[model samples]
Target: MQVMKFDMCYICLACFCIYVSGCERSNNRQIAGEVEGERIYLDEVDGMITNSLYEYLFAISETRIIAANELINLKVLKIEAGSRRISVDSLLSMEMRRISMQETKLKYIRDNALQGGVVDERNPFKLHPLDTPAGAEILNNSYQKFLRIRLVDELRVKYRARILLSRPQPPQVDLTNVTSHARGNLKALHSVTIVSDFDCPVCREAYPELSKLFERYSDHVRFEAISLSSSVTPPILFAECAAKQQKFWEVYGYLYGQKGYDFNIDSLIAQFELNREECKSCLESRDQHKIIETDMNRLRQVGIEVTPTVLIDHRVYHGPLTDKAIGRFLDDLFKETPNPGN
Candidate 1:
């Protein structure tokens, strides 16, 4: 929730208006400015900022503000690159190609296996059922991903190549006192803890991937799912009640795989073959609310600010909960140690 100061924002707005006025006066021609004999154009900055804003639905003033900031930053970077005898445009094009290829590969898989006529059963990423609102949701998410990739490509070229920012330090979270509903071996060498909300769509999307990882690496990795909020407390408590009957996974899957958040606990109990009397008693006890509160407090202590934040061995990852990304993270962790079974 950080924001620039009002005066600073006002200055940015003034600069933007001046730049736009310059462009209009020049008959909407490309060149907006020059940096150390190198030409900086309005179109290039527009392209970068426009692509960045594609995924967002902001007000016109807000969009202009963002575009102005991006344009200013890009001009500074271009000047720096010129000083270093480097071509910013060339670097950006190369990075864009790299990002484009990676995105293309992911989309190809999604199209062929998930969205196309034939469903590939072996594909790890689950596709939302067609003819459903969830399907449209997933499609919109994919489009956003493409737009983000474009923004990332431009930013990486500007910052990463020049080492403008240092690598971010991971959050220091103490996991010793945390309790988790877990699968896989407790004594396993590596631990994967997911602090997530059952009500969160992203967390629900990550569920199957984590399940697959647990299944695949049960011997080597301990997998824990800690419920992080009261937002989905009812379903979570229902799952806890099912856990009392040793049917947690079944209930967990049923809840997440359902079309929407409106859950019927009694119906779920019958569907999952849980003992009705015991589950009803457990639900009525209200003890699971305390458990959820404890988890949320623990997350807050560790500066967790998002749903579906993951801690794989001690490294934290936030959002973009794709199977491939998680797999790569796990692979990096695995590479640092001897075989877990050893």
Candidate 2:
């Protein structure tokens, strides 16, 4: 049995938003090169490589978050161990004995087996699994890893330790080609961008939660969906055609509401009151497919390769797509704090 791991990185942006950049913006505005007797500033070159810059900033922030947690835990460990007149290793050993992980894992396995489910011998059941199947001998190493994590969490609470690092600021996405499909407050400071394909199953499953996000933040947050189909899916282009009539969101909802991937063009026309001849012409010409190409090109420039990549406020968000997770993100984004450090 292995103990549960603790996440010292809460990734709480609200707690980490206290960054006060001392660097001058005038540096970026400094003239770099002259083109045809015209002076060129760094902003043009900066714009071209904003993706790499975002990645660099993200790396720095993530490293700071992780290293701060590690240092805080070490300090707390030393303090607690010193109070008890024991070495840090001895303190960890004592704490590890108190965790009921063995009983928990056995119960979990027993419950799954009793329910006639095929429990994977390789995953959570396996203690510190190697490349091969899990065995009992290697379990001690896995237990030790989890023990330290749990101990760190306990010490953090005892010491009221906090990590102080600001979250990275991502560059703004180019929204010119995608404005037609956008819904919500156009002037709102906060925005959500989803790169998705209509036929992708994961995209289909995500719409419900996305719908909730739209509804929940309808007042302040705008949602702009960009198609991710490399080639044309008729339904996807059809939605774009619908955008001309200001029915993109309606078509978007109708497409995702279906239980299966296959869509009927005539049914869509009938339901949405679109002109049959024009809709057919639009579908045949594939003119709207260019929107997808534009989306693809823009996403590539930003280093996104997967379907359903969600960017909130132009920052790539990699978190669970649940209401609670989104709520925490929103809270982090909108709430004020004395110091932004997590």
Candidate 3:
């Protein structure tokens, strides 16, 4: 039986170990090439390993990783023997570039390890899709690989040894206190809030799915719709003012269900006589500006750069809503303990 000796360094790095003829120096000397298993076959001084491959190894080291692919004449750097003493940049141009490449790789891996997976052209740094068996398997494998290489003990401690890249849970909505929304006492548990501009076509597309989600989960979720048009009609203002009069959800339905602009605030403003000055003042206040800014910040923080930005719990969903995305959010949310009094 041929027994395989465990070369700890390469095994730890998950590199294929290779044994080559006439190269057995194991102490503190510099060697460079594609390192398979125990093999140290050298490459030309100018041989380049792309930054994508180098950063994975660099992530394990103490230095910051820098991309060497853009640098001129880059090479792979490796530590030889056990001595930390190595030549400075002026002494070995190729060696310096290699060290730089190693540092680059290490930094890249360390940063992404915190994110639970590496971002590459292929994976695109997104939350791994787990809708299918193949996708689920891939996500699981990536998470496992992330945990294996990451050196941060605290992260490993907090993650329960499992890597997850989803947003944190959102607080539960209070269905019983629905009247409070009309009373102008609005508070969101999260620092960032989302105020949807309902007139947006993309928002129109999202409304139904959002409505369904709100119906199922309104007890803990709080989303507000604010119209951006300067013109007001009776139906529009009536619906909004009635909400303050403890009739928000009902008016919301009436206003949104209407097929046309016949429901604009200007059309219903005189009918409701809802103190136009107060309503207009509320809509135009710097406070409203602050609210929109808060929403924008929340979207940006979570990397939602486009509209139809739906803040479901703590997760930010971009583009128009999808049943699949909503399902995923619900699935993830239920996995946690429901909030008290939700």
Candidate 4:
């Protein structure tokens, strides 16, 4: 298993993860390449990259933010150490002693040990070693590094340093025939299309909030769910068939309301008022799965790799949907765009 190895490195740079790859200041009009002697500009290549691989841009933007903040933290730490007339290393060593060994952070480190991988080897100075005892002295080394970051955080606030970088926006995709279950204000100004798995616990937990989003902004937003599941079949194929009868959302709520339980035919029919024989026939049909495949293929083109990917006005937001995040995003968007015909 690949791990963000538990390695201690040449301080500061390693602690802060200041090396951000795939970031550059480019002149848009510069000739990036030539395609059969026709000039291809930087902006053209950039636009293409952003469209097909938006996550690449997102990662660059995130690391750039981290690098920028760490730069601030470093500056603040230097100023504090200088004021105290001590070497920066001495200051760090002194401050790091205040960290407690029995904090909850150790558990987090252990939990996250298996999830790390080579993010970008552009700057290989920072290393995440395996958590194995044979790999490195686990506890002390990780805790010392933790203390360094914790100190960096304290110094950042103390010095009134803040990061002002904005995240890169996701590519906008114009979706058609993605789902038959499009709901809420059909003619609404903003449209939200969520592609997800009903079997996902996170997706289930978020279902009500998204439904409420439809209800709250029923006049301003249109909503839909494109069902896709990897380990299951009935819920995916069955829901799409139900969508033909405008019973998709009913089936959706029913499936999720089961709370990770296997799909039940009797309960589904009773709950959704679904026709028993018709549903059975449709669910059994190989053609019904084609509808699901069509939806998934359409979404995969827009980079729908994970469940519950929300596309608001075409920008992709991955992970479980949340009210605070979605609400704030909607508010900002509404502010940017005035009411229609205004």
Model number with the top lDDT: 2
Candidate 4 per-residue C-alpha lDDT over 1-342 given as tens digits, one digit per residue, 9 for 90 to 100: 111221222232233222212223523356779979999775655554554444544445455665787789789989999999998999998887655444455464566563352111354555545454523454445556777888888888888886666655665775765754677777767778777786677778788788777767767777766776663377787777677677887777777766666568777767778788888888788776776777777776655667767888768864236776577567656667744742
Q: Regarding TM-score, does 1 or 2 come out ahead?
A: 2
- Give the winner by lDDT: 3 or 4: 4
Off by over 4 Å in 4: 1-167, 260-262, 318-320, 339-342
- TM values, all candidates: 0.50, 0.54, 0.35, 0.52
lDDT of each: 0.63, 0.67, 0.42, 0.66
Error of 2 at 334 (Å): 7.0
TM-score of 2: 0.54
Clashing residue pairs, backbone N/CA/C < 3 A, model 2: 15-340, 15-341, 16-340, 16-341, 17-340, 18-340
Which portions of model 1 show Cα errors greater than 4 Å?
Answer: 1-171, 230-232
Candidate 4 has an lDDT of 0.66
lDDT of 2 by residue, 81-194 (tens): 999999998998887767645435455346434323232335645233233343333343444565678778888999988755666667565556543367887767777788
Clash count of each predicted structure? 0, 6, 41, 6
| Candidate 2 local Cα displacement, residue 305, angstroms | 9.4
**Sort order, TM-score high to low:** 2, 4, 1, 3
